[model samples]
Target: MPQAFPIFPLLSYDSRKNSMTEARNWADKKTLGGRGHFDLQSSPASLVLDSVRAGDEGLYRCRVDFKKSPTRNARTNLTVIIPPHAPTILTKEEGQPVWTMVGPYNEGESLTLTCQVDGGKPTPRVVWLMNGEVVDEKSETQGPQRVTNTLTLEKLTRSHLHAALVCQASNNNHSTPVQTIINIEMNCEFYVGFSCLKDNKRGMDKF
Candidate 1:
């Protein structure tokens, strides 16, 4: 009868630093000098990260030393993907109001809306959708932590009334995108015998 040896009895891992190896077991979470975020997989010789972060992205090396065979080295890279915060829609001039319904303006009035998102590893892209159709898609990076996109409608028409406007923010395909919505409300007009009539619904007559 023959005895079988285990696969890669002892495996060591390290992150690439300055193009050199620092001689550390990065996959040993319980080790004194280990990063504590990684766990070594014995059977398949893999490294598992418990919770990934932006700083943990880089090239990694695994060294497998066999008692009767030549030592083998393999390298792999890790990339971290961070999801962005929920999108916010700002309409008011002074305060940021998360309005579910905005308007009651004249049909010919213009409109402007701003969408903002914060804290994504690769920066989030913002887009505007009206009634399930893409109206605008543009994003600006304010800094390393914030991104913004603005939508402007030159004139609001009767077709915009009760229309759903959505602002979507996304950074990666793995996670669901964050979004916010607002419904447009236009002035109510009644026509009787070719004469236009306005009703005082929200305190103002004729929008």
Candidate 2:
């Protein structure tokens, strides 16, 4: 009778694991030939790794054994990586954002606030938010380090006074996220409208 090769237990790394130190096992328990499994069968001698992440960098071995047989094995390692998304604002930057009237904008002229974040790997994604909700606009990224995210609110009525604006810079690769916020004044004075009304009233009674 031909003697069967043995199974050997080894270590492996799975980036998706809940804990970094946690190890996983993957090997074909039964082999076609008691002698050993050649590279022919992808199952018994092969493993397919998906979404390989940075944490997956480590060593692994294949453990094999047969009834009343000695143990034999092989070794393989894997590495998984995920790329960066974009950069966004975490909190109010250095300067206090300024707002002003434009083109006789009595209703607190629509102003623009641009935020920039520096440094990230594989670049990052830029997004703008209002009171924790994402603002609807075309988000764009530029340069190697700085990413610019802008928020444009058209015809901001008095309802949006003292609105909270936030900028979120995202790079899914990193464990901790980055973000920024701005307590923007989105309201205009009603006095401007009241003055206009007074002027129109004063000029009336001619026809």
Best by TM-score: 1
Off by over 4 Å in 2: 1-108, 190-207
lDDT of 2 by residue, 135-168 (tens): 7445556776666766666776776666666666
lDDT of 1: 0.74
Worst 10 residues of 2 by lDDT: 31-40
User: Tens digit of lDDT per residue, candidate 1, span 29-64?
Assistant: 333224343343466645655456676676666666
Task: Flag clash pairs in model 1.
Answer: none
For candidate 2, what is the total of clashing residue pairs?
A: 28
The TM-scores of all predictions, comma-separated, are 0.71, 0.42
lDDT of 2: 0.52
lDDT of each: 0.74, 0.52
